[model samples]
Target: MISMNCFELFIQTYFTQLQVLDISRACAGEYINGFRWEQLISTSIQHLRIFALQISFKTNDPLMRENTIQQFQSPFWQEKQWFFICSSYSIMFDSYINLYSINPYRKKYYLLGNENTTEIDSMPFVVQLDIQCENV
Candidate 1:
């Protein structure tokens, strides 16, 4: 599990590129590296509400399967957008992502593999997330 301090630093660093309001916390000219951590977190929270993320992981190995689910449920991944890009600094996971949803009460996950297919294929030992939640 990632410690709170680590998570905070992760958030701070990940959001350093964000374009904040041109006010007291702006990082560029007329500002003094004034970006604040709270602002970065707020931006991330907003992104969570508005964006759909594409996440992928291999699960051929039993141990990896367990890790995938655990990572999915971690605090860093609770936000859907982060989960889509959290595995590695790779862009391939962003391809061919189709929106999907889950039923928490049923503990069931649904995937859209191909638009023309009617049958559910056997689990391919790979999990991909293209989840989209309504902005609230």
Candidate 2:
């Protein structure tokens, strides 16, 4: 059984990987100084069965948002079973949140949402993925 702390660590690592991918994709056309992390992930972490990607951008411009969406929907990455979660609020302020997951062999994305937002002061979103491998 995975401990609570270990699970938290796993989530953090997943978030980090997603951030790196987003940054790389956004700057793909530009002359970047660093190598892509996707190559490293493909070489290492062979046992990884699930990937979660989350992208957050703080901007009021519509064109920037469109560009960000385009980068995420690019075909440079292989196609796999994907799960996407999106939430946005445009009331007093504007905010958008999205999370994505890919798993080759199983459905793993989990959704947890709160029932009441009246008492809460902010929007909350959750995406969870479970991955397990069995030896044949």
In terms of TM-score, which candidate is strongest? 2
Whole-model alpha-carbon lDDT for candidate 2: 0.34
lDDT of 2 by residue, 1-136 (tens): 2332453454445433321121101111121211232333344333333445543434455554445444444342344233333333454676543333333233434322233234423222323333332211
Question: Could you tell me how far off, in angstroms, the CA of residue 76 lies in candidate 2 after the best superposition?
Answer: 4.3
Report lDDT (CA) for all predictions: 0.30, 0.34
What's model 1's TM-score?
0.23
How do all models score by TM-score?
0.23, 0.34
Give the total clashing residue pairs for model 1: 0
Flag regions of model 1 displaced more than 4 Å: 1-46, 50-59, 76-136
- Per-residue lDDT tens digits for candidate 1, residues 8-111, read 46434443333221111111111111123234446543333322223333223334333333433445445443332223222454322111122212212333
Best by lDDT: 2
TM-score of 2: 0.34
Report the poorest 10 consecutive residues by lDDT, candidate 1: 24-33
**Every candidate's CA RMSD:** 18.7, 13.7
Clashing pairs in 1: none
